[model samples]
Structure formats: structure tokens, C-alpha cells
Target: MAQMRFITALLWLLAAAPLAAQEDARPDLSIREPERGARARTYVLASLIYKDAEDGIDRFPLAVPELIQYVEDNTELDVRLRGEDRTLRQLDGITLLYMSGNNAQLRIGAEDRRRLGRFLQDGGLLYAEDVRPRGLGRFRFGDAGRSGTPFDRQFKELVKDPDILGAGGSRWRKVPRDHALYSSFFALPDGPPPGAHQPGTITDLEMLEYRGRVAVLFSDLNLTYFWGDPQAHSRAPSLRFGVNLLVFAIARQQAGPALR
Candidate 1:
């Protein structure tokens, strides 16, 4: 009887171990409310679940808070940072969805893809960034190559989905240096900042335009890391770039039928 009880206890602990690990993997999904009567723009960071891999979301936990502080301090925009780390199912009223990860074959179900499609059609903007650190080397643009980073391959898969940005003949293309987004708030005369990765070549912001509105923007330079440690790295320019993106997203939403 004593031996049987000991074996049962051991089995129970083994069963609970995976559950504890899963709980630890999921970050807090709490939403921070804005000040009373403040017309705040909320940015939601998407926490994705990759198949057979540890959670790759929330790579730079400090990125969002730093961005919120920059926009509020430098601009008149009422920026509000909220959401602990949310999943796609919790993204109903979110205006801007920010996603970062490094899973090569990251997969989103068909239903989630449809939901994301509707979000863009309703004037929401999706911004995705490759969070892989520098010195990792470049991702192969075309064809399958082992040299490419996981994020590079995942980003390609994300924008190529027919139900997502690829619908209605939409596709990702480089944002022009003279585009209004470059000058939306702060003038990015030189365009995106040079990071450890993709140094000196970060000229244009990649965009996916649908019905004349930029529905999605992708960056491979790891801008989030710049925001992660602004003071330590003197990342004011990268913060400015983030501000421009938020301002541009709001403007597009206000443009309404003009965007069509």
C-alpha cells in the first residue's frame, strides 16, 4: 500500500509539470486603463503560440512601455499602453496589433486569419517585426535556404497568406523614402535606423497596402530592441520611427473613404 501511494504521488507530479510550464510561458494579459477623459490610442502586443515550440512572443517586454512614453512626451498624441500579452482571440477592439517572433513555420489557424482580415478591413493596422538579434545574418528573400533566420522565413509566410495581406491582390512592397509616413510626425530623412542586423540597408519600411490603405508594415531590423533600452543605446531616432508609425495608422483610419 505504501509503495502504491508513493508511485501515485510521483505520477501526479509528472502530470502537473507540463501544466506549470505552460502557465509560466503565458505572460500577463492584463489591460491598463487610460486616465479619465483621455483620448488615448491603445497598442496591443500580440502573444502568439507556435506549434511544438516555446512561446516566442514578448521578446522585448520593455518595448511597448518605452514607445508609449516617447509618444506621450514628444507628441500631442494621447498614447496608452495596455495589455499584458494578449492572444488573437482577445484582439477584438484593438486598433494596432504588434507581433514579434522567430518561428520559421509559425502558423495561424484559418479562423484567426479571417479575423485578422476583418480587423484590417475595419481600418486596423498590423505591424510585425523580426525580433531576431543582429549578427544572425540575413534571411533569404526567395527560395528555401538554410542561411535565413527563422523570423525571415516566418515573416514571408505571414504576408503571403491569401486570407491575410495577400487577399485582393495586395502584397508587401518597400515604402518610399519620400512617403508621408516618413514625415508623418518626425522627419525620418534617412529612413529606418541601422541596427546590428541589416545595417545601412534599412532605408524603406516594407508595407502591405489594401484599398490604398497600408494595412500592414513589417520590419526586419529589430526595432523593438532599440526601444527596449532607449537611454542606454540613445535610441531616440528609433522611438521617433515608432511614433511615425502610430501617427500614420491613426491618419489612415481617419481618412476613411479617402483611402479608398
Candidate 2:
């Protein structure tokens, strides 16, 4: 009886050991990417100077806060908002670099331009918007009160492939009804603001190849204007476009890896 009792206790101990080991093991959540098999790591870089009210520019409010909400509602991708205190070296970990025109000071410099070139070459996707003072397309940098259209001159140099952007310099074109972004991520009232709308046409779209990686760089079509405004619930069209742009960014990144 004693020997049989001891054997029973030993079996219990052995069974519990595996469970204990599993509990002790640290889960590598870092390697996990977004849902739907998205492997791209997304990062938002914001400049400190852009937020300073003393800079004369009306520090626009569209930024990481809005991005966080979008990510929470949309995808499971790991997203982080980085500031100037961080090193440019850490940029390697990021697959998508969101350049909200909020950081005009950083985007306009010569040395910074060189760094941006290398970043794009190393498979980093850029989603740039001209979020000038006042409203989304109302303020251009240096040129006071100028309409904040797409930063054409700079992108023209980066996106050398003419096919990326149509004959005109607009990076954002009307996303057609049959486009992957329209069906997969957006549709009708819920998707990209329908094909028959005013600004939903794909007038200026670009699929530029940089460092063997094709990137779809685009403007948010007045997205920043609608952000952070509680009274603007009627702007469903703008919000849908914002969501579509994100889906497009992630989808474009995945396209390269799939072909490989």
C-alpha cells in the first residue's frame, strides 16, 4: 500500500512539471506581426518642433492620437509613435514610416533628405501628408497661406518611375471600385467614398519602385482636416479614405514579399 501511494504521488509531480515549464516560458510577442499575415512593422515619427506653438505655424492636431485609434479599430499590427529623442538608427526596425506634414522642419532639411533616401532604399514605406497650419490643404510651409497640396518636387526625385504617379504629379488617385483596397478593406458607404464621388477618383496615383521594393506613396486627400474634430461626424467620406490609405500601405508592403 505504501509503495503504491508513493508511485501515485510521483506521477502527479511529473504531470505538473510540463505545465510549470510552460508558465515560466516567456512569450515572444515582439516577433508577432499584424493580423491577416501582415509582417510589416509600422512606426510613426513625429518632430517636436511641429508641436511648438511659438513656431508661428498653427500646430496642427492630426497625429499619433488619431493613428492609435485607427490601429485599434482596424488591424493588429504592432504600431509605435517615435519622437526626435530617438536615434535614426532605430529606423531599421520599422517597415512603414508615416510622414505627416506636421513635421515640416524635419522633412525640408538637406541632411535629413539624404537619410530619408536611405530609409526608402531599405524597404521603408512613407505615407506623407501635407498637414499645414489651419487645415489639411490650407497651409504650405515657408510659403505662407499657400494650399498644402502634395509635396510634388521632393517625391518626384524619390519616385523616379513615371508609372508611380500618373501624367500629373498627384500621388493620390481615385481608387476604382474593383481595386483590392476597395473590396478587401473598404466597400460602398463603408469603403473608400464610392467611385462616383467628387474627390474619390484616382487622378494621381503612384506605384514607385525603390531599392527593388515597390512603395505606394500618397496624400491623404484632406484627411488631416477632419481629424480630432468631434463635430465632424458627417465627414464619413474623409474617414473612409483615411482607412483605405492605411490598408493600401500595408497591402503594398505585403505584395513585395508575396512575389518573392
Candidate 3:
């Protein structure tokens, strides 16, 4: 275990260094388009299933694939979900980690937290959601049930360690109605369209920012459920919002940032 401890210590040192010089330590989590006149690109999106997560981790089974199909249908990008979504114990090769669940007691062990830290330092986006069961929006189970709400202290603890996630001391805020996320791809003129939950439960999306980019975005909208259920209300807008979110997360890398 001597080598392992040495490597871990090295990673901590790298985290304190410049983002540019972190190439060797950081995981490669970039999604960019091919060069002009070159072949188009393909992306594989997946959800994170952390350890000790028995329930809610895979709730709304059809959510991810449905969202992927929606993105491909509406945008120029070719996106597909890994088979049944990635059953990952590690974050290697993941540019965006879609972590959605409503279980307030979600528990991630120490090792996975370190993996997340390295992933964020590598410039990955963690898009979390509270996927309320169909027609069960009110089952919020009080504050803890919501994945990313400012009041969900349990979820906050998951990422509170700056030494672990490089985002210590951060807090969620109401994403302003004028935030570009509303119009990244589709035009959300009035801000995020209403979520699946009851009206006004959330006036806007909440985000945790880091390194000048959105490190985590939490929503109580039950968006994935809406996308999966074909008969659900506001299904179209939900899919549209999904596309906008995916585009915004990777747009910076698509611009050919020199970090990689």
C-alpha cells in the first residue's frame, strides 16, 4: 500500500497546482467536435450508480436512454446512453456524470468521493436531479428527498469537502431567470419551464459553481421521469431542456479549450 498512499498524496498536491499543469493527474473528461472537414463526433452519456445505493439509484429506468434519443433527434450531436446506463464504481472516461435520485440517504464511500474530486478537477459536470416517481411529485419526503436543494444538507455533505471535490465552502443558489442555461440551445424565454413537481415548488434551477463553470446543478423537477414517460405533460419542453443542459455543459470544450 506504500505506492497507493504516495499516489494519493501526489494527487492532492496536483489539485493545488494550476489547472493547465494538471494533465497527468486529472481524468480526461472532454467532449469536443471533430476538426472541420473531419468526421462528426459521437458521445456516450451515462448515469453514476454509487456504492451502497440500493434504492432510487436506478429509479425511472427509461430516463437516460429516452433523454439520449431526444438529444439526437433535436440536435446535431450524436449521443447515446451506455447499455442500461453505466453501472460505474469509477468515473474514468466520463466527461459528464448524470447523478439523479431522490433517496435522501444516498451514501458514497470515501474512495468514490476521491474519484469525484479528480473528475471535477478534470472539468466534468455533475448534473444531479430528484426524479420524483410518476404522479408522485408530492412524495418529497420532506427536505432530504430533494437531491440538490439548498436545504438538502445530506446531499450537500456529499460534496462539501474541498479536499475531496475541490469545491469546498460552495452553496447552491437560484439560477437567475436570465442565466444562459435557459437559452443555451432552445429558447427558454421565461427561464426554465415548469418542472414536473407542483407549481412554484422551485422557481428556478439551483447550481453549485466551481472553477468558473457549473460543477453541479441540482433540480427537483423530476425531469428524467417526464422524458421517459411518453404520456406525461410538458414532455416536449422537458426534452428540450435536457438538450439545452447537455449542450451548455460541453460547449466550452467544443470551443477547443487549450486545457486538453
Best by TM-score: 3
Error of 2 at 236 (Å): 3.3
Task: Give the range of the ten consecutive residues with the poorest summed lDDT in model 2.
Answer: 12-21
TM-score of 2: 0.49
Backbone clashes in model 2, listed as residue pairs: 164-206, 164-207, 172-204, 173-202, 173-204, 174-201, 174-202, 174-203, 187-191
Q: lDDT: which is higher, 1 or 2?
A: 1
Clashes of 3: 0
Full candidate order by TM-score, most accurate first: 3, 1, 2
Predicted structure with the largest lDDT when compared to the true one: 3
Instruction: Estimate, for each residue in 15-72, the C-alpha lDDT of model 2 and write its tens digit.
Output: 2221212443634333222244333344443322322222323233444356447545
lDDT of 1 at 181: 66
Evaluated at residue 87, the lDDT of candidate 2 is 33
lDDT of 1 by residue, 1-260 (tens): 42233233333322222222245564554434334445545645443433533332325666777787776676655445453555666666564677776554567788777777677766677787766532323642221112246776666676667776675433668877877667666678777766434334444557876655667787776777677665546588788888777666554543332122
Give all TM-scores, in the order shown.
0.68, 0.49, 0.72
Residue-pair clashes per candidate = 0, 9, 0
